[model samples]
Target: MTLASDDKVLILFRHAKAEQVYGKADHERSLTARGRRDAMAAGAWLHEHELGPELVLCSTAVRTRQTWEAAVDGGACGETVEFDDSIYSGGAQTVLQTVREAAGEAQVVMVVGHNPTMAALASGLSEGDGSSAAHECLAAGFPTSSIAVLRYAGPWSGLDIGTAALERCHVSRG
Candidate 1:
């Protein structure tokens, strides 16, 4: 769980906007057309920034899965992806546990799920100085299909409060 140094990057992403249907199960809700475009844009941003995740842990919900697929299709990341049911209803603690369990060999890891866990995790982990714009955006809110990039210098198990520096945040504009 202890990495050699603070050379790891964790990317937190909230799933794109999903359809709202009365009486429909939340797990089965799918993304809308704009959501698809937003997801793709997020992926492209990751690719362009060279921050693509080596491993992607995505929620099992339809919208989250579709978001990951769109990101992958857009050349954001090409690697192993695990669909985790826990993330569907998990909180910040659950997300912390999931990241702690990630493979040590993975230099970059991404989690795709819902909010406010994503927002909470990002705000909770961030410490020290970072991009002003990124911090400002995060302070405002974590919108759907948004990405928060954090840099930490330690093992995954050692991830804790104020352990990381917020690198940047990107919100999909559709």
Candidate 2:
């Protein structure tokens, strides 16, 4: 289904900093104190910008879930938080597929997951319009609590590399 101009915002979020501990699976990692702060800051920015998400799709990983909880924290947003197991350790292409699958249900959808994938997905969908900061962040692997908004002009099923344009990119670290 082709997305309406008003129904085209796809916000990609990278999970916040994870507590350092060896031997534990990556999926079990939890956010650190600073990570919590950064997530909240990003959340504040989202709330301030009036970017209320209509749907939130997050990875089932511990860190991602924590980040979403702290960041959103009942802030200005619509209902529903769907946990997708595929995003736990998904790649850029997988992330894009996940977003495409849910394109028709909401005007704005937020996907909270891991880095490299999140960053790569942003870069892939972006038609080179991502800001220098965005490029830098994606190049460096999105840090804790980063958000990238991509505006797609076509149907989600047709979404491919460089099909969308990065409209906004923000990292709480800075």
Best by lDDT: 1
Candidate 1 regions with alpha-carbon error over 4 angstroms: 1-6
TM-score of each: 0.93, 0.88
- Candidate 1, residue 53: Cα displacement in angstroms equals 1.1
Q: Would you give me the overall lDDT of model 1?
A: 0.86
Model 2 C-alpha lDDT per residue in residues 64-173, reported as the tens digit of each score: 88888878763535467899988886788887788779756577788889877888788878857757766665666567788887777656677789877787788875
Predicted candidate 1 versus true structure: per-residue lDDT over 131-173, tens digit per residue? 7888898888899999999888777889887888888999985
Pairs that clash in candidate 2: none
Please give the CA lDDT of all the candidate structures: 0.86, 0.78
Model 1: worst 10 consecutive residues (lDDT sum) = 1-10
